[model samples]
Target: MTFSFEQPPDKLTWYHLGPLLDAEAGRLKYNPEQYTVHGVSNNAVACCWAGLLVDGDGGLVLTDLGRSMLASWKASPVGQRWLAEQAALDEEMSDPAAPSLPAPQPEPQRADQLGLFGAAS
Candidate 1:
């Protein structure tokens, strides 16, 4: 089926994607039109149209477009924040000595400000 990425019904989130991701990653068998996320059921057609999945002789497979889209979503500001939080949790689980937080990213200076409190030069 054909679908456009210009505007999707939902903004993809990390939540409710475990099944689909697992299927794509080969962790689970693809069972076409038999997955749900956040109480909403997903079908192969919808996924294929969204570029998140493709139909193959075997079953369904994740496409490069889907992978890239997911990566892009995860790299967004909000996504980055989530990543930091997950990293913190993972650190706690794997090694207590590791830093609990990600390095702070400096905020961009306002156009009116120069260095610190100095006026724009």
Candidate 2:
């Protein structure tokens, strides 16, 4: 299974909650065709590992902890900020102007971001 968002925001895990909230609002569908059978299965299993959802007769069902946590988070300022940041990231991976490529003489390369998580690519 993959951690959809390898890096969480504000250490509050808004990425995980966003999906649960979507599920609560009936926007998240468990249709395997939409996200492949393994994708759907992997996501549900990952959510279960996060303790925010569980396997149900129909599909993955959000847990009580997930709901309560989302509610509590929304009531706090930090949580609000996190949500805003998450919204931005979800909206676009890159925005505004980007730096021009280095001149013919390039700079040293940086290590793979995923390397930090033991999943180098």
Candidate 3:
């Protein structure tokens, strides 16, 4: 979660917005009149940019670039482990195999759960 930047003495600090554009899709809409150079320095500027993609209901629908970034992250080892842990938790919550639970109890159903033919009853 931490990144270290090492620079030799007397080196000028340079930062670029190119990576931000890549990480967040160019779909980030900015108001030309309201957005000044000074506003770019604010931390909320990033959130403001991302807010453009949000629907009226306040839900974010990912664009192709965002989906690609998510796919790339899911392919990484850490992301894979995180995804696996989430799946395990979901499975445990839905279909608890613990002996303590009473018999004949039905497993909880999720809309997205996949089965051989359809969702298990």
Candidate 4:
């Protein structure tokens, strides 16, 4: 089956990527860091790296790619239909009122953190 830009890469098919996408788009009101993933997830993002990035706090942030893609999609006929759906979703979410997500907190210093294996510091 053909996949749309809204769908994550095949490697990430197992993961529920919509929350991550909505979070990036400011549509999902939840801690973005909670949706954090690395390794394979990073690879998937890399395929379409333009929209997503790891924030300083090890969270995800919507990048220019995300916004641009949405804008582009909204500009097209087919995508405009998708945009209408998204708008409906937005309306639904408006009433339930998910809490607004705050910016990521700074990563704390780990001075006493152990390095590598049995090697002494």
Candidate 5:
């Protein structure tokens, strides 16, 4: 079965299979031997591999094949509309020039016009 962000697998194994087995139901209970059997170098390698799958926007964007599988799922029309509205709201919120409460202006100062700092005048 294809994996996507929308419907991710319960137990995704890559480097170390120990954690993956632990997460899965009816799997051998947290055995360290799973990693050795899988030929995984270390737990850190597994974590790094998982981290690479994450996108810069923090949303888990899948590969072309994954996206194609996700597109097959029938989403509710109302849910799709709500998602669109939320995206629009997010765009407006992130705009730099969005209006805010008026700020008070500070009195302007001239460096050379100060009495002690000024020449004779």
Candidate 6:
């Protein structure tokens, strides 16, 4: 019925966009962009316009609607799938043991007969 900063959420809103997110964006912070989970980007401004967040003492805090949306997202099966996938992606991205992307190849500097130029010079 009530939300408290001290209590952990049912599902962390901050990490993988789930785990890390819960620790980062889910809490009240000194930064001004906590509401949108990122700094003053389009989504940040849009969230304010959408009434999902508002200016608080030091930064943006979630409005009632925002909290409800987060609650619903966490409760849904899609959210679970997305969270799991995101967590895996994050792990893969950071894992030194995971395969690294192929090194970029040098591109041709000149245009071809078809007038197509290489993606990079």
Please give me the total number of clashing residue pairs in predicted model 6: 8
lDDT of 5 by residue, 19-94 (tens): 3322222232223455554333344234324431222232223334323333332154644665588689999899
| Candidate whose TM-score is highest | 6
lDDT of 2 by residue, 27-121 (tens): 55567786775435454455566666655555566667656766777778987887798888866656556455666843345345435578545
Which lDDT tens digits does candidate 4 get at residues 5-69? 45433332213345345545555432435445542354335524433333423334445544445
Clashing pairs in 3: none
True-vs-predicted CA distance for residue 36, candidate 6, Å: 16
Report per-prediction Cα RMSD to one decimal: 15.1, 11.4, 16.5, 14.8, 16.0, 8.9
Q: List the residue pairs that clash in candidate 5.
A: none
Q: Which residue pairs show collisions in model 1?
A: none
Worst 10 residues of 1 by lDDT: 36-45
Q: What is the lDDT of residue 69 in candidate 6?
A: 69
Clash pairs, model 6 backbone: 14-20, 14-21, 14-22, 15-18, 15-19, 15-20, 15-21, 15-22
Report lDDT (Cα) of residue 102, candidate 5: 89
Candidate lDDT values, in order: 0.59, 0.60, 0.40, 0.47, 0.40, 0.54
Clash pairs (backbone) in predicted model 4? none
Q: Model 3, poorest ten-residue lDDT window?
A: 7-16
TM-score of each: 0.43, 0.47, 0.37, 0.35, 0.25, 0.54
Q: Which ten residues in a row have the lowest lDDT in candidate 6?
A: 15-24
lDDT of 2 at 76: 85
Model 3 RMSD vs true structure: 16.5
C-alpha lDDT of candidate 5 relative to the true structure: 0.40
Kindly report which residue stretches of model 3 are placed more than 4 angstroms away from their true locations once superposed: 1-53, 56-58, 99-121
Quote the lDDT for 14 in model 1.
Answer: 49
lDDT at position 63, candidate 5: 38
Residues 1-111 of candidate 6: C-alpha lDDT, one tens digit per residue: 323333233442433232223323745434434435444444444455555556565545676766676767867898888879989999889999888889886556532
- What's the best-to-worst order under TM-score? 6, 2, 1, 3, 4, 5
Rank candidates by lDDT, best first: 2, 1, 6, 4, 3, 5
Model 5 compared with the native: what TM-score?
0.25
